[model samples]
Target chain A: MTPERGATAVAPVPSETVTRRESTSRRVTGPRPGTGWRQRLEIVVFVTPALALMATFVLWPVISAARMSFYSWRGFGPMDKFVGWRNYELVLGDDVFTGAVMHNFIIVFASLAVQLPLGLGIALLLNRKIRFRGLLRTIVFVPYVVAEVIAGVVWFQLLQPEYGVIDGLIKAVGLTPPEQGFLGTPDLTLATLFVVLTWKYLGMAVLLFMAGLQSVPDDLYEAAQIDGASWWQVQRRIAIPMLGPTIRTWMFLSMIGSLQLFDMVWVLTHGGPANATTTMATYLINQGTGRGNYGIAGAASVILFVIAFVMALVYQVFVLRRDTKEAR
Target chain B: MSRQKMRTFGGGGPLVYALAAVVVALTLGPVLYGALGGFRSNEQLARDPAGLPDPWVTSNYTNVLSNEAFWRYALNSSVIAVVTTVIAVLAGVMAAYPLARYQFKLREPLFMVFVLGLLFPAAVAIIPLFILVTRNLELGNSWWGVALPQAAFALPITVVILRPFLMALPKELEEAAMIDGASRVGVFWRIALPLSTPGLITVGVLAFVGSWNAYLLPLLLLREDMRTLPLGVADYSTEHSADTAGVLAFTSLAMIPALILFLALQKRIVNGLQGAVKG
Candidate 1:
């Protein structure tokens, strides 16, 4: 082919070569023989199964939830009974729903205030040329991978009112354990769950910050140090700004994740001690499937979905835009 | 500060060591305590909750392991996770290939839909999904009831990770195969699929772990006999609330399989996470 191309070279060969390159680029961008029905057919064949499954399972459910929110159904029956806005009205008016929304806010605020900074600090510590760095990283991140049910069970044992590990240690120090235990006390349940949440998810934020830190040029730190900036100042002035994208990404993820939290809370407290730890997700499940009130559950689902969708969209537009643009 | 910043040694200090030690202890303490506590009898646990077992017992483990319910739960979890991973990966690979290689008008928009799927947590959509699966589709209480929706949820991450990976492969290889008169499907199967193994493993491990540990979907979709490991543990706890030791033993047993998988594929999981987040 090379010899034939050379032998057939003509006066306008440069233009021909340029056109061929464009065609080649198009082929690289997509399947060859562009604008042909056959190529389109191949694309359809490749994509149909995935698109079908996603639409049927993911997309359809969300749409159906929207439709189901206006009707009263027992989750097992037809959606024949229509109650326009009553389900939403009830969900909004329900004290438990209010409490669950408050709990979700508390989690989001606490994650932002506590877990994010704590993770960054640890990432900075681990990013240092420290011994056992790999070991430390592995140990911390192990919990993120461990099943939430197990984390809940593990913490359940620790926070038991009487002879659990935490109480045992406290009693050994001559202090009394709280009367209702950590998980059972309304005063302490949300706080205790927050602590557990921090423990479970902190590793993810730390690892993310660590990845961000790797991209930071070491010479910048050196430059800051030579300018008489302290170690803390170097991090605050340079490293942090450099990690802005990562921090934002983690914050978005953390907020959305906190909103949708289920398994850990379900396993730990079942949104109990007077619904103290109920987040949007646990509330939806407990009310919907647990009580078989599909209509109200669907209403709650729409509310939850709107919250998640709006938060994500807002973050992607207002926060993530800069990071993505810079990448491009 | 009278210190030299040693990049190689991480600028070690006594304070750093102290902080690191505290973090490690805090992080691993509960897990280790729980795992070790499983070896103690209920009596011993009550007597000295803070201490090592005075008389270690293997019977707790033996009893849980030998129980038919335990195996049943474990097997159910395996089936759900494995099935979800396989289907999710297959669907993701097919979808990602075109999204990665093609420059069609709808390409970016289609990819965006999958990306947006990451935001739709199962909690927010469980009601209708439950209705659709159990009532409309009549898959209620079946393994597929859980597995199908999970695969759908798993698709977004799988596609996101695998698309970039497929894009990174050399385009010339496919062209070479095509010049030999190979069809598009032939090139995809022969060249693209084989080259995507690492990406496959990354997506596979992720989907498998996510499915294995998933709580809400299985909780809603599957019944008692179809209960996965996490469900089984939850059920066991409620039923055996009296036996703290037995609950711990059950928890320990449930933790082992996922732990083994995570430990074995720690590198891939961590790196894959970094890749997915960065992407």
Candidate 2:
């Protein structure tokens, strides 16, 4: 959970550090102009409402979930039994949980490989003076504006066996459709889910890349062309390198998004067909509500929170540090 | 190299047009088909699954529109989304002002807390939230049960957007007003709020659409009578399992409000999101 404040904070690292030392030295040199208690109270008044809600809803729940994970409880019972690590143990040993984790990674892999490339290609194509640029951009972004559950329902219809549009098109081209249907088959469910994910998500990626492309100086391309650079070379050495920050941002978003995949899976397959499409989110919801085992669900929630927290922290430190330094 | 070589892939050619067409088809084709499918009969859909309906029936739309359940769900969604947007925006404005204008010690850390809120996706916290709202708070089935958490979750992005806008306001205006003996609160209300209208609208639209499109929170919190549009969409799927046309119709109905909002603020949303990523 990297804060936006961190963006400004990280950017002015040297200056801020210098100012901090200068302020301390100034305090040593002379009496500082002290802020009144009234001013401090006013700051509190301004920030308290949001801070209160965030504490109750986000921060408190995170802490409570960690605690709840340690005790055995059901949906409507007291948390009397001290289960210790039993719930975590059960979750760790469960095949469904493991499968869900693997499925999340599959989505991450697919998103990195398929979604980003497809988005970049479409963005590049649209970046040119193609026909109906506005219309095409709007059309591509339409799916993203639509809700995830609705996307799930729409794709569910399209991927229906023999009767769906995909199968109909397959038949029209004289090919055999999958016999067990898309969502109904274990081997094909995750892959089909990937297709739907790509369709629903690629637009955002395209938009991000388009924004990045807009910032790349036209003179760079012109200069490269004058150097007798081929179109591919210009893209490889100029466009792609220039797009590093945006690409990194999109990749981070896509990874976290894949980790938290729930609505589509819940609506379309409910992690069925041998749990092929199960994600950690679906697993948590299943334990929490579908089964009413709050303790197990709490354990799952903590695990997910830890994974996401660690991933974000590591990504910020190792990956984004270079970008921030380069920007400075 | 010639100036012609500077243009990638010759800029405008048959091949580029062909590729653009393919991209368009792949992106918009399914949504268009789904929307049109609602107008066709179930039999029509089953028979000719990929084209315009010969006998485009209004019954599906009529059926969903006339159904009391659909309206109830839509009404619930509106109430929740509206309440959440209002609370989130108000709180965001209040909180962002201090973060932007003050150089207090807690300013960065407090702002960071709100930013960290963005990283906690609602999915992971549902369990504890369920317990806290239902058992501890006794807010089960109420609109606030869903709305409060939504408002809370939205604060990070709302504050993120608003703080920068607040920071950009000229301090001389506030100083000029203070010279006239106006209080800080009065200056904030009369000056800063009016100046940040664009940022407010941007955050409001984002929060509203997000609340309306939300599925899991309402799914967990509400009962049958209190079902939101998304839950209603799921209900339509289950209750009318055999009626694909009706399901699609219900889906289209649930979508229209959010879509209309997005279309109205399309430019703001697009630019705001683009700026968010770049920032």
Candidate 3:
């Protein structure tokens, strides 16, 4: 086929000759075939399994919960007549939701605070040629693929109130071990969770950033070195600038991940000590799935979804677009 | 002066080395705590959680293996994960083919549709997934419930990873097969599938690891007969006595497949990740 095309090209191949190419271009930049009923049928076949599955499984629940939000009903009883924001009224008025929202930010803020520098430190360390680098890389990537629930379970023991390994370590190191269990105290629970979350996730972040670092052109660093820039200066001006996009991606995942955090908290604290560690995900789950307030849960979800959706939109439109546009 | 000096690699600077050491230790500490410390006796565990088992009893290994539940969890996890991996790869590869090859209308839009799966948290889809599993499909409390949805969810990344490799293949070969009067199915099966080995392996490795380690979907869907490895970890830790050993044993066993998967795909992951960045 290539040879025929090659020969035809030498012989001034007719423009209308390439049937498949013409078809493809017309299909993409359309108005030629007008509307491709055949193509649409094929698409249905290709995408229907996924789309049907998602729509039935995903959108149905979404719509169900949204409808429920307007009513005052637990999952079991007859749907109460629409109260039109009464559920919102309760969510807004509830100290638990407000407190959980604060706790969510605490987790996000604390995680980013710890993960950023720590991730960079690990990445920079690994980037340097070192002994057992392969083994180290394998080890670092371990936690990332492990089930988040197992991570919670493992860390809980380490942080248990009595005879827990982490508590033991704290006393061993002469740190004032709290009288109440680490997770039992509302004040300490969020902080302890923040630390644990950071430890578990920072490995993946470091791996990503290290991959970003490897992409920074060697010549830029060579030029920086020739300019007699110190190590700190080289990192600041060249490495960080080149790594800007990756850092932004990391920040986005961290935000969304933190927003959706339930596996760890559910397994570890279950929003204990007056719901101090409760997050939006946990709160929604408790209401919707646990309490069977399907409607309120749906509304709460729509609220949470809206909040997450807005944040996602803002990040994509504002941070990502602006950065890429400026970079260009 | 430094460019002229080329005397030693600055990459070997002491601070850089030290930083890597500390980070590596911090990252691997928990994994080591489970793997190596599993051999130590209960007395030794309390005495020094930090120490490696010396004069290693290896009894923890024996004790864990003796638990009938341990084997059950292992077999169930493997079957579910293996089945899930097969389905995910099949669907992921099939879906990715049209996006990769056909340049059809809505191609980019369709590809983006797949990518959206990455963003929606399990909560967003859990209710629906559960509804489908339990009420609609009558798959409630079955391993199939955990396996199928997890496969569907994993398809996006698997497809993306495969598509790039497919795009860069020699279209001449595919065309050559077609010209020999081979049908589209024939072309895809005979020509395309065999050539995409590395990409297939990479996606397969990822899918296996993903299904094996999954927790939330299983928690919401599966019950008694469908106890997965992560479920076992949760049950063992929260409900059982002397959780340290059981939890450690379970965690270590779960981690083996992941680590082995990583090792098998290490080169591809490194390459694939870098390719993604450049693109």
Separately for all candidates shown, the number of backbone clashes (residues 3 or more apart, or on different chains) is: 3, 0, 4
lDDT of 3 by residue, B1-279 (tens): 344234123456676667667766766777777777667666676666666787686777777778788788778889888988887777777777667666566887888777666566666556546666887789887877777777777777777677766765667787777568775557667877898877787778778877887777787777765788788878887776474765676667667767777777786776666544333
Question: How do the residues A233-320 of candidate 2 rate in per-residue lDDT, one tens digit apiece?
Answer: 7666777676777898888888888989999998889999888888999998998898988889889988888888788889888887
> Sort by TM-score, best first: what order?
1, 2, 3
TM-scores for chain A, candidates in order? 0.88, 0.87, 0.84
lDDT of 1 by residue, A137-162 (tens): 88888788878988888898899998
Count backbone overlaps in model 3. 4
Expressed as tens digits, the lDDT of each residue in B1-279 for candidate 1 is 123243323466999989999999999888888778879888888888877866788888899989998998899999999999999999999999988777678888989889898988878778888878887799988888898899999999899889867866778888889788888789899999998887888899889989999998888788878889998988888889778788888888898887788788877776766665555
Clash pairs, model 3 backbone: A57-B128, A65-A298, A68-A295, A75-A292
In model 2, which runs have C-alpha deviations exceeding 4 angstroms?
A: A1-35, A225-231, A324-328, B1-10
| Candidate 3 ranges with C-alpha deviation above 4 Å | A1-44, A71-83, A322-328, B1-8, B47-55, B175-185
Question: What is the TM-score of each predicted model, taking all chains together?
Answer: 0.91, 0.91, 0.86
**What would you estimate as the lDDT of candidate 2?**
0.82
Best by DockQ: 1
Q: After aligning candidate 1 to the native by TM-score, how far in Å is the CA of B4 from where it should be?
A: 17
**iRMS of each prediction:** 2.9, 4.2, 4.1
Evaluation by DockQ, superior candidate among 1 and 2: 1
Alpha-carbon deviation at B215 in model 2, angstroms: 0.7
Please give the lDDT score for candidate 3: 0.70
Local accuracy of candidate 2 as per-residue lDDT tens digits, B50-120: 97977788899999999999999999999999999999999999999988776667877888787678789
